[model samples]
Target: MSAENELLLIMERISDLTATDAEIAQFNAWCDGFKAQEIQVENFDAVSERVLLQVHRRINKKPNVFLPLYMKLGAAVAVAVFIFSVWFFSSRVKSIEEIRYAADIAPGRTGATLTLGSGKKVNIGLATAGDLAMESGVKISKNASGDIIYTIMPDNKVTADAVNTLETSRGQQTQVQLPDGSRIFLNAASSLTYPASFANKKERRISLSGEGYFEIAKDKAHPFIVDTRGQELKVLGTHFNINAYSTEAVSKTTLLEGSIVVSTATSQQILTPGTELINNGSSLQVKQVDTELAIAWKNNLFLFDNEELGTIMRQVERWYDVEVIFVDGISKERFGGGVSRFDSVSKLLKSLQATGKVQFQIKGRKIYVTK
Candidate 1:
């Protein structure tokens, strides 16, 4: 018989005693055979009517089988629909929770060590930001802003050699000024290492860990190079920011004024005003972006654009030094717009919870996530 007729016959026997396991298996085999057919069966109404007729016929023939067969078919149909719905919804809900979980552990804030010229190490977080004299003839002073500035005078030279290193714990942010009249703003859990003096005539260099925004001094004769996480940014004199946090997948360099060159081991690209470069270790993509969004963190704002909850939490974890745990299956919610970083963690959570999709609880320095 034709496939349609066979289906109708099976449907008719669905509630009858003759509709045994072997008969059901035969129907299943027929369905499997036609599974690869490309033709669309456009007569669903007819199929439904035929199925109902088959069920009624079976009920009249074998009343004992009517309830069990109907229940079994109903259960099978319900389970199929449930599985399909779950798959559809899951695909639509990107793995945003996984992203948030990764961001939570990603290292943006935390601890750091300062190594003096004498090879002595000082844990800056434990020590007060006051004048701490080192054996290397250097005096270290930590300002209230959490900057570690050094003053060193060569025993023979009249000019003092001053160096400044700014570092923040995993949940902290800080700013510093270089001896060369340049300024730097560091994001949470970041560090900058610079010399007391740019005595080198050809090139001046500094190393960075995490993220920093720089307003470099205008000295065309001496270029500034920022080294971080396998990438180097060279500038004659420009204002720019570098986000090379080890936890991030891409090292981003955004230029605000003048021009700069970003180079990795595999590629090099030059950037001009209003341009940003994202280096993914193996590839580089240059794009034009709003400078304000790139440097918003320095201005104490959290900007997002259809960003997942996981990404938003990473930023929070860094600035507030809090641990986040998700108790719910994993939030697939995406958030947009911006918020002030100056607000407390609870306030931020409340705003997010306002969406009615998720909730948060703060305990000590840890945040628990629920949905």
Candidate 2:
């Protein structure tokens, strides 16, 4: 085939349809040739320009076949230039917003709730961990592991009830124990809501946000249920983790110790230990996974196994309570490793930099990414 036809074929493969692996490989090779020529432009602009012009002339001989390819090539080159410029310049002068966005929060951040069971809102955040304080006769205490535990006094009875939830902002995490003996470790940027009393015997339910690990006290008599982002998780009593962060494209429910029934508006799946249910907006898929990886956040660790840069940043944004600024091209890089959530944002970036493909800058709570 002629050079013009080959260029037209590659452009058609990229623009009109999903490119096959072979075609994509060819296109990448072409891109590399352009990149090589670009490197010499600083020292020999005229020579580089002449070479590009000659190539363009040869490829443009067949206007009917080459017009689309020319447009696509132009777009691709523009995108490449934009990506390089952003990464090259932003790395030199870091901003506070960039740093703040990069830091991930360590687990066990301060969190508490205001119980307004009797028309009064109590400040539970200030209450010491494991110390039981009485607010209108409702006993509230922190557990040995810094989880908030609530117990209603046997004699205390009220008609009106309200639970004001306290959640760790991005970059924070906390644990809590329900009145029913169930334990919950809330992930960063997560919240949980429950009533002051178990008042109902048929079922126990709570609302959740972001992500959390749960160890439900087996009460076969009363099935425990979690409501999160339009999904429901039901179990008689079991251990599991639910990640329902609104920012995420999917809601994940991973079973650790017991069986779980996960249901959305249109689908349902029964998940066993070592199995995970992922509900994207359109469909649900259940697959087996390493239970340890799913619960790593509970242990103050950030684990990634071939995870994309965007996914990794979401975890960082939640833990450190920061924002992420992708001022450059979206990173197509995938990473696999484990890092302590306790590390500073800069430290985490340094670890990622070891890969030698991507670099980051942390200014305060923001993180800026470049390549």
- lDDT on C-alpha atoms for all candidate structures: 0.66, 0.67
Writing each residue's lDDT as its tens digit, candidate 1 over 172-207 gives 676655546677888888888776567643778999
lDDT of 2 by residue, 50-96 (tens): 33343344334332443334335554454454334323322322332
TM-score of 2: 0.68
Q: Provide the lDDT at 61 for model 2.
A: 39
The candidate that wins on lDDT is 2
Candidate 1 residue runs with Cα over 4 Å from true position: 1-114, 119-165, 328-332
Whole-model lDDT for model 2 versus the true structure? 0.67
Q: Pick the candidate with the highest TM-score.
A: 2
